[model samples]
Target: MLYAGTRHRDYTLRVPLAGDLVDAQEAHPQGLVRLVALDLYRRQLLQLGEIPAEAITLELLRSELTEIDMAELERADAELGKRFAPPRPGSSTGAASSTPSSVTATPSPTSGA
Candidate 1:
C-alpha cells in the first residue's frame, strides 16, 4: 500500500500484495517515482500470484483501505469528491440535486395527417 499527497489534490492508489516485498533498488533514481513504485509493488504481487494489476485504481483503494490510514484516505476522498463532483442543474450553492426533473414531450403533427 502507498499513500501519495498533492497540494489541493487528493488521489489514492492501492495495489494488493500476496507475496514477498519487492526490491526497489533497481528502479530509476529520478522521474516517475510513483509509477516505479507501483511497478515494483505489482511485480512482487504477481510473483506471489496475487490480484491483477487491472484491478487496482483510486476508487478501489479508497474502499478496501483499513486502519488509521483509512481515516486519512476517506477524508481525502471526501475532499476530492467535493472538489470534482459534477455541478448540480439548478442549485444555487452548486450542491447536487437529489431528484432529477422529469421530461415530457407532446407528440408532433405529421405532414399527411
Candidate 2:
C-alpha cells in the first residue's frame, strides 16, 4: 500500500502487487510503468484501511489521489494507448489515425473488358 500525501494521510493505494506485475508483463511486453500503475490501481484500490476493492473507480482514483501524482498518471494513461493495449483486428498501433478518408479504386486501362 502507498501513502499519497506528504504527511501520509488516510488516502492510500495497494496496487501493483506481484500478480499485477506478472499480469501486466503477460499482457504488455514493454511494461510502461505509469500506464500499468493506473490500470492496476483501478483494480486493486483506493484504500483507507479496509476499503473494498469494488470501491475503486476511475473517477474515485482521480479524485482521491494527490493532484501531483494524478497529473502524471493521467498523461501516461492517455499517451499511446496501443503501446500497452492489446491490438485488435484492423487496429492501428500508432497514436494517430491511420485510416484514410477517401480511397478510390480504379480499374486499370490495360484490363481487357
Q: How does each model score on lDDT?
A: 0.36, 0.45
User: Whose TM-score is greatest here?
Assistant: 2
TM-score for each predicted model, relative to the true structure:
0.25, 0.31
Consecutive 10-residue window with the lowest summed lDDT within model 1: 104-113
Which whole-number lDDT from 0 to 100 does residue 31 have in model 1?
29
Error of 2 at 52 (Å): 5.3
lDDT of 2 at 46: 42
Task: Tell me the tens digit of each residue's lDDT in model 1 across 10-89.
Answer: 22223323231234434445526544444443342221113345664434444443334344433433444454456688
Which residue pairs of candidate 1 clash?
none
Against the true structure, candidate 2 reaches a TM-score of 0.31
| Model 2, global lDDT | 0.45
Candidate 2 lDDT, 27-98, residue by residue in tens: 656757755665565643344334455655555554556655455333433432433346898976667567
> Which candidate number would show the highest lDDT if scored against the true structure?
2
